[model samples]
Target: MRKVVFHKLCAELRSRALLEETFHVTIEEQVAMFIHVVGHNWSNRPIAFEFMRSGETVSRYFNLVLDALCILARDLVCIKSIDTHQQITSSHGRFHPYFQGCIGALDGTHIPACVPMHMQDRFRGRKKFPSQNVLAAVDFDLRFLYVLAGWEGSAHDSYVLQDALSRTNGLKIPEGKYFLADAGYAARPGVLPPYRGTRYHLKEYKGTREPENPKELFNLRHSSLRTTIERAFGALKNRFRIFKCQPFFPLKTQVKIVMACCALHNWIIEDGPNVYVYDDAAWYEALPRSVRNHTDMHQENLAWAKKRDDTAKMMWEDKVGQTVP
Candidate 1:
């Protein structure tokens, strides 16, 4: 982190009165300690030894910073309306008319977690280690709009998404605006997914294998756009090393750490340097493909399928007209 960014954060915390100079530890040291904990996943003992303080003191101030960051989350992480008209009118070619009403992309990522022996089964999914499934939505700019963490690793992506939709104050979608999701999620009123059994991942569309049909074209574009969330996840995990490994904190504190990291991620995106580069090819090759389940398809699901078909047809016709020779 830059010194200017660090001082800026200190100023903000001081303005909120969240941090003040202790007798021995100054506010800057407290903020630095918090950053070290989140950035490096340093345990209380190591942090205390480095700061010349006791483990108890380090733990107390660490929790205090965590609580403060959680409190600031509301202001930092938010969903703002994108200007559809300007986006379509701009020079950005592929996303113009097709993604006009699209607000952002949504996806689920597994964050490593440490759980008790009795509860490890529920937390351990396909991965050998225990983890938590986190659902997050990010806009084109790579800023997180909404995040739901703490779901057990074994929980399906659709299940976590369903929980998100069921909450009274959960993920909100405007009437016409929709978010692009991967095949792991059902294409519904507020969520639009690519056509099933089609080429969706970016890796599938490398080189001469371009879209052969309208559905394929839509899938290609959808994969390109929806991969934004994966890049967001990569950037988040890359910035905060705590996500790379399972911290020794309890399950509940681990959840809070996820949320706190998200809040800080957004803060860096907004104020920090433009260091987060979205490497699509590398990211696509690294992540495991999400398993798609088509069971229990309902009436609304059918309607969403029809909606995708109609949108694909419209995009194809538009492309044909533009390429007329």
Candidate 2:
């Protein structure tokens, strides 16, 4: 942030004639407006005081920055390359290529907010609060890829992705590449869900409400793949602290704040470890030791478990169904 602010934005903008988000404001003005929005509780009063600008001007410039950020985010937050194999590299480290075939770890989080009395019915979430449902995807790098805001809190995770996959052309992920999700979603060609069982962590289990079979193995791999999303969500909530609390804004504004936080997360990581005081210890301490991985819960059949897992499942699925090359 310091480098971007002090060096890139400040120094560079002053040196050149800058393009702007809107004709009503300059790029520098938009930056200031953006900083004020994220810095304050995004309240118009505070923004007016901080910038010594009228609320109207602040609102104008704030939207300009947000619009630009939205466009940038739409382009940048997408899966660029997907490699399915894990490659061992001697110098840099072991390369986890399996993540390449995967787009992101996806989960739906509740973003609370004030709602109109009449509209509140639709906005009521699983927690029974007035809010918006935010569906986010995080890559292995912990960078946010997709953020779907503006859904009513009552919406389910499966419904959220269904809209994204079916409606949005830009998000047209190839047929074979899959994303990791929790059991909130059902399994299909391009999405995977975790196993439902008394004993899990393996790629497959025979103890579901449904019949036990090789297909059940997909659930186990689903659990393993979906862990990344849980960790990502945990870290995000811990960092913001506000996500856990009810948002005071109206449902519309709440969506804006959620997207802004995602952008901020990218900004913080880009600034590196020192720019933000990331509570790595707090996060680890919060994790259930038994739930860290499937093995952490004491899986007795380790070797056999690995075998029944997805060595051929992904291959067979590709042979029979669609496979991304």
TM-score of each: 0.87, 0.64
Q: Which tens-of-lDDT digit does each residue in 94-152 have in candidate 2?
A: 11222345666778877766777898889897776777787887766677767888888
Residue by residue across 83-114, what tens digits does model 1's lDDT show?
45343346355777677788788999999999
- lDDT of candidate 1 at residue 28, scale 0 to 100: 84
Rate residue 218 of model 2 by lDDT: 47
Q: How does each model score on lDDT?
A: 0.80, 0.57
Candidate 2, 41: how far from true, in Å? 2.2
Using TM-score as the measure, which candidate wins? 1
Scored by lDDT, model 1 comes in at: 0.80
Q: List the residue pairs that clash in candidate 2.
A: 82-100, 83-100, 195-219, 203-217, 203-220, 203-221, 204-217
How well does candidate 2 score on lDDT at residue 210?
39
